[model samples]
Target: MTDRILLTCGEPAGIGPELAPLALESGVDFVWIGDPRHLPEGTAYHEVVAPSDPVPEGRLPVLPHDFAAPATPGRPDPANAPDVIEVIARAVDLIMRGESRAMTTLPISKQALKEGAGFGFPGHTEYLADLAGGVPVAMMLASTTVTPPCRVVPATIHIPLSQVPDALTDRVLEQAIRITHAALIRDFGIAAPRIAVAGLNPHAGEGGTIGHEEIRRFRPLLDRLRAEGMQIAGPLPADTMFHPPARSRYDAAICAYHDQALIPIKTLDFAGGVNVTLGLPFIRTSPDHGTAFDIAGQGRADPASTIAALRMARDMAANRA
Candidate 1:
């Protein structure tokens, strides 16, 4: 049986619900896992069932769940938090059971989740790792252009800059590299990917003046990874690594922390950036942007990112299958 992609429109309060119809029209075969009530009135939908249901025709198929009171755009209700998480869990189960091939999640608001559901972890990456039985996961931001092609994995995610050094370790760096390399080959179809490791300090520590992490931790990891015959480079300066010419030299960039990796990619392709979680047993992708609370109900939400996410999810699922 061909695997259908599962798309979870996160919080109904955000743009997730709004972007559903556009994503459905993108020629990707997927099951919408959310409340049917959130979709535009009169929109045709089919209920998802156990033991694999046939793909519904002429309308987007929906795997419905009982969500809290009617959804109000831009205004999240704490009462609905558990229901939102339940949908995600079901989608994950579908993938694990081989009923689905991949998942593309719409943006979800963390604040709303915590207030609504008593959620833990900063965001999806951490939550997903936990859900998948504690496999270590790395978030990679990818774009379509191979000329100046870039894939970024931040070593220290969602933590303050002050805490980065303590978190940076030889094992962590090596593990991140392995995950990125595997994902490139498995999901992106790259073979023997060459990776560039960005430095933790300014000017890559300016010979250890700015930070010793470059001298003590990053350099050793680079040496080890290189000896292992991984086509890897750098403890190079972060600022210099992202320039067009520099980025063209490798398959992916491994950065020391969140901002180091994300800043460059977000600047280069804000609307098209896709967040991919590597090392999961199943393919999981999402729009790089978050739930746009400010413009939630205004019909001003741009569906470009979500569309890109669905397309990428389809590609990954096809490749994996």
Candidate 2:
């Protein structure tokens, strides 16, 4: 596996710039794509012409892209939004061209990008899917650095609570499960990964008292997959599925919606969670947390999630190889 990874510096006004320098100390080789001027003052960085250029210890390796305006912490500049998007595109291009093994990203502000550049996608996942020619992908928050090492995939994401039921269709759930299952085998090296499915309502809809989607939609799909020789379980109660004993039963937990999946993992290991995109042509991972604007330039942003993301990206790339 190539030692170099492409790192996109997200929103200049956020903690992304501050985290970049700290991530350099993680012992994972990466070439950061962003404007060096946006980085925290007194940061040590080496400007590199290519992703494969040598990087020295304690110094960030940067592939500079100049922003149109200076970045002030906690105050996003719209003029620099285009450049933020450009860095992500550049990272994607490098990965496609085989210049980098994988891509790890910092948090980006969708609102800032939309207001500035008329960015149309919902978030980075959708934008990346479009970049990869509209491939079907699932976001998996995998916690390898924490005990029990749980991984989760939400069946329906970025939708309102009312729309979650309709969005969690048979096709969508099956696709998410298939992608996650394949990723566990290929990217995580699990020979027979057990996946636990979480029900949408309380007590798994109390067997149809609270809701019927689990009975009408989830069960049939899970049964079909189980018959196909996949190690699948549940339509289980969402409340109890995340306990230690319960988590140990499965390699991954597939939930009905965004919060159902994310809440448990974040509760368990907020700092160490890594957001991995499953079924992408190339590997992509990011820190689970977002761009903390309030803490930007405060010199207090923790790099734990960023470090975990880089390590997970490296491991996934090696597994794919």
Using lDDT as the measure, the top candidate is: 2
Candidate 2 at residue 41, lDDT? 88
Best prediction by TM-score:
2
Whole-model alpha-carbon lDDT for candidate 1: 0.83
Clashes of 1: 0
Q: Please list the C-alpha lDDT of all candidates, in the order they appear.
A: 0.83, 0.91
lDDT of candidate 2 vs native? 0.91
lDDT of 1 by residue, 246-302 (tens): 887888999989999999998888888889999999999998998888888777888
* Model 1 stretches with alpha carbons more than 4 Å out: 50-52, 55-58, 145-147
Candidate 2 residues 79-99, lDDT tens each? 999998888888888888888
Model 2 scores worst on lDDT over the 10 consecutive residues at 142-151
- Report backbone clashes per prediction: 0, 0
